[model samples]
Target: MDAGEASVVLEEISYFEAVLRMLCAMLVGIVVGVERGRNHRPAGMRTHMLVALGACVTMVVSNYLFVEFRPLGATPDPARLGAQVVSGVGFLGAGTIMREGLSVKGLTTAASIWAVACLGLAAGAGYYAIALTGAAAVYATLTVFEVVQRKMNVTRHATLALDLECKDLSGVMHDLNRFSVQQNATLSHVQFDETEERGVYHLTAIAVFRGANPQADQAVFLEKLGGNLNVKKLETTQY
Candidate 1:
């Protein structure tokens, strides 16, 4: 067969291989995405599947270029495009993470996005073993680690931000101090802003709670503070 004919034959063969690789990548992505979805994570099934599929296709393209150009006295860098995929995936991962007041969310979801992208690259390169192993590892970390963390009474440190409006600032501060002592929570910071309204003070405090039942303690503290008639408005957030 002539060179052109031979090239056509190889291209046809590659098309079949590409289909398999893309499908494998998608499957792995779906598996990993499901675990995140169960937890109501932002980056779930569809997001993960797309990341994996994109990475896989990029790898296939890189490989194809290397093969197509190698015999034409061209030294092609197969890793060039794949390298881009690795770095480019970071932007997508960043989108999954978000911070609201004192609470930050989507860290695990971002991690999952990055992991699935790597798995896709592996699957596209025909490294089924690595891809499957990675998917399993990702799933385990998401599901099993959570159970272990909860069972071990892992202390999750969160920055508690409280906003209070009160006519009696001193009395409010005193009550907060008493509540902290009761809950064994530390007041890391306290700030006050004098509002334009007479006798109205905007008090902001940062509390750090560390214990087996910090969340429960926080709820109780809020309830107690809310009961005070002097406290006009109270808003709290766990960061």
Candidate 2:
């Protein structure tokens, strides 16, 4: 066969192979996304599937160019587009991380996103073993290991962010100090803002609680603070 005809035949074969590769990539993405979805993560299911599919397409295109341009003496790097997918996915991963109160959350979700993209590139490059293995790893980290992590977290001190709306600015700081001492919680990052309406104010702080029963301590803090006549509103977020 002529070089042109040979290229056409190879392209047809690659097209069929590419279909399998893309489907494999999509499957891995779905696997990773499902774990995230079960835990109520923001970047779940559809997001991960698309990332994987897009990365797979990129690698397939790169491979196609490398094959089609060989007769023209053009050396196209097959991994060039795949490398871009790895770095370019960072922006998308960053979107999954965020601050909730004093805690940094969604870091695992972000890393999973990046990993899923890599899985796509692997599948697109026809490395089914690596893609499948990586997906299994991601799923294990999100599920089985999570239970281990929770068990390990029992002795860890927890941080809580407190936002308070108070009816009186006068002597509230002393009252807050008294509350902190009573609860045996360390309170810091305190800031108070006053409003135009006299006596109305806001109080915010970071509270650190020790011991094994932080949930109970948090409940007590909420109950006591909420019951206070001086506290018009109280909000607490745990980390």
Q: Per-residue lDDT tens digits of candidate 2, residues 1-239?
A: 35686478466646679999999999998999998988899899989999999999998888777777766777668899899999999999899899975678889999999999999999888899999999999899989999999988756676889888898666666776776666667889999998666888988998887746766676776677777788888887777
lDDT minimum window of 10 residues, candidate 2: 6-15
The residue ranges of model 2 lying beyond 4 angstroms of the native Cα positions read 1-13, 163-184, 193-202, 216-239
What is the lDDT of every predicted structure here? 0.85, 0.84
lDDT of 1: 0.85
Output the number of the TM-score-best candidate. 1
The clash count for each model shown is 2, 0
The parts of candidate 1 lying over 4 Å away from their true place are 1-13, 156-160, 167-175, 219-239
Give one digit per residue, the lDDT tens place, for model 1 in 149-174.
78886666546898889988889889
Error of 2 at 63 (Å): 1.4
